[model samples]
Target chain A: MSEVIVITSGKGGVGKTTTTANVGTGLAQLNKKVVLIDTDIGLRNLDVVMGLENRIVYNLVDVVEGNCRMKQALIKDKRYPNLSLLPSAQTRDKTAVSPEQMIKVIEELKEEYDYILLDCPAGIEQGFKNAIAGADRALVVTTPEVSAIRDADRIIGLLGANELKKVELIVNRLRMDMVKRGDMMNINDVTDILAIDLIGAVPDDEQIVISTNQGEPLVGSDCLAGKAFENICHRILGEDVPFLDLEIKTSIWDKIKEIFKKN
Target chain B: MSLMDLFKKKNSGDIAKDRLKLVLISDRANCSPDVMEMIKNDIIQVISKYMEIDAEGLDIQITQTESEGNNGNVPALYANIPIKDMKHTGPAR
Candidate 1:
């Protein structure tokens, strides 16, 4: 069965775009046909993250407004043959697309792709509603911070209220070093407060920044965040893969590097 | 305070959990305060059918409790209704 999922985080800058890029890429790596839709109209970033920014001839608004077909708006990724991205319109606002329009677009994409991942914009506004309209489930991405958790709790309630109750939590940017010092919230602290089934928890890693800077999804790479994204894909595929042990065994060199960075 | 006392002080993680527990209960039951009035009134009407009750003393609100899912916590509705007397009813009609 085809599943349409919206990756959302109520607060902005909590790795929503990065999660959408990596998860979609990971799914494609598993040989599933996946299409990522950037629902953050007026501010597009999925294209850059997927390294397909220059190929965006048409956008979500073009498809919705009947200016172009869905295929014309979808930009195929260079690396993944099964992966594509439907970039949102930069000139148009969120009001350009309605929930009904979004649902219609997703239904068409459903027949072509095994999974349709929507990169939802921040805040519970019109864009958020449009992104989630056609989604069968939700993957809420949040960091291990109080502010992010507060917004995530609100998003979960909003998701339930909107009848999209099949939701999973992805705790991102977890720093195990800080967690050991009792300075940062751990997996249990987040899940206990959120009261939702955790899908994956990505450890804080600098490689994520490098990959994003290069406009590359790190799922195929060898790193903590990359492996976490791969594990998330496995879980999404119903493979019952266990969560990665994100214990950061700090070596002498790592401790020295941290000291240098702090200095 | 001694150095041991500093270590014994509540860690930031526990403090965050404590604060979020209190915040989310109100946040989750965000429809309270306004909807609470309607709920309290409806409860009074229902309870008054079976017994004379102290509607003024009825206290109902949202609180947190231990959850079953991986030891996580969830918001629970805590209702405290004070009953004045039971209305005597004859056997089923």
Candidate 2:
């Protein structure tokens, strides 16, 4: 069965596009036909993130407005034959595509793909509404920060109000060292407030920046963040995958405690 | 300082969690403390007219509780109004 999932964070720069790209690529790597849709109409970046920016002949607006066929607008990735991207138009704003049009486009794509991932824009505006219009599930990505968690809480409430019951969470950019130092919110602290099923927890890694810059998703690599995204993909496919152990490095204080216990 | 406080200093994570707990409760309830106060006053006025109740001891709060069948947590409006006595009156007075 085909599943339409929207990857969204109510605040911007929280790795929504990155998560969509990696997870979509991860699913494709699993031999599933996947299509990633960039719904951040005016500020399109998924294409660039995927390193397919130059090949865009048509965009989402063109497909929805009947200017081009849906197949004509889908950009196939060179790395993964099963993975495709429906890039958003850079000139047009969010109002260019209505929620109904989004649903119509998704309904057609649903018949051809195994999974359709929508990269929703920030805020609960038109872009967000259109992104979730035809989605059967939602993956809310948030960082381990106060503002991000607050916005995520609001987004969860909005999704519930919109009748999207199958909602899960992805806590991204977690710094274990900071968490150990009590400077950052831990996974438990975040999930306690959000109260949603956690699909993945990606640690803050510098390799993500390099991979994203190169237009290559790090899912197939051995990087900690890449492994985390791959595990999330398996979990999304209904597999019982164990979460990555984001244990902080042992400190001198912990060593002292251990010595005392031994004594 | 207390021994517990010494062991567990108030960190940023603790502060964030506490703040989020309060904020989420209010956000889910869709009302501020002032609005809750107004609601409490209105409920007291309406209920006191019918029964002799302890107006000062009434407690009305929006709390999170488990729903039937253990579906999930839901925001519930709980009112604990103390009933002191009942007003005795003739019918159709």
Candidate 3:
């Protein structure tokens, strides 16, 4: 059965778009037909993250406003033949599309794809409502910071109020060394407070920066963050996958560099 | 700066967990059916230690009550649990 999932974080810059992009690509790689919808209308960037920014004939606004057909708005990914993206309009404001329009768009997309991943905008506003309007479940992303956790709790309560009870948590950009040193909250510390099943915990990796810059999903690469995202895909498909055990240890290159330094 | 600090200093992770629990109490107090459910579960666990209670008939909610410090009214947790039987042992504490 096709499922609609929204990747949302009430706070900005918590890796919602990255999770949506990678998970969509990962599902497609696993032979599932997936289409990603960028719901951040005024500030659209999922297209750039998917390396399909240059080929945008129509957008979500066009499809909802009847300017173009739904098929016309879909931009197919050549890398993964089963994956597609419907980019948001950069010029239109968030009010341009209502929650009903978003539900309508998702309903039509559901018949053609196995997975429909919506990249939600930051904050609890119209954009957030539009993203979660037709979602069967939600993935709340947060870092191990006080502000992020507070916002995540608020978002969870809001989701519950909306009668959307199937919510899961994703702790992103967790530094294992800091966690071991008692400087940062570990995964358990987060999940206990949030009181939700953890989808995945992505580590703070420089490779993620590179992947985002190249406008590509890191799920295909042999990186730690990519592997965490792949496990998330398996868990989304109802497969039992264990969380990554990121032990605190310096890289061998760091060890070699320390040996060469003389005080 | 020294090894002694490692033994004395509180782990920030623990501190964050404590702070989150307190902060969420207020955040979830507003229109939270989940918060009420969480409180209900907590009440059941704690009261279960003293006696056999009718779990099916338990009811809990957050309501305004008089503050102990003579301040204005504040939100309070109130629970009504029916007792089925008293445990042979005294309060677990």
What lDDT tens digits, residue by residue, belong to model 1 across residues A149-238? 999999999999999889999999999988999989899999988989999999888998999899999996889899999999999988
Q: Write the per-residue lDDT of candidate 2 for residues A47-153, one digit (tens) a residue.
A: 99999999999999999999999999999999899999999999999999999999999999989999999999999999999999999999999999878998999
- Write one digit per residue (lDDT tens) for candidate 3, span A131-184: 999999999999999889999998998898899988999999999889988889
| Model 2 residue A202 lDDT score | 95
lDDT of 1 at A141: 94
By summed lDDT, which 10 consecutive residues of candidate 3 chain A come out lowest?
Answer: A246-255
Off by over 4 Å in 3: A248-263, B1-6, B31-93
lDDT of 1 at B54: 85
Worst 10 residues of 2 chain B by lDDT: B84-93
* Residue B10 displacement (Å), model 3: 2.0
Model 3: DockQ against the native?
A: 0.57
Candidate 3 interface RMSD after superposing interface residues: 0.8
- Candidate 2 residue B33 C-alpha distance from true site, Å: 7.4
Give TM-scores for every candidate, taking all chains together and pairing residue i with residue i: 0.82, 0.81, 0.80
Per-candidate DockQ values are: 0.60, 0.59, 0.57
* Model 3 deviation from the true structure expressed as Cα RMSD, one decimal place: 10.6
Instruction: Supply candidate 2's per-residue lDDT for A197.
Output: 98
* Model 1 alpha-carbon miss at residue A241, Å: 1.1
What is the i-RMS of every prediction?
0.6, 0.8, 0.8
Clash numbers, per candidate: 0, 0, 0
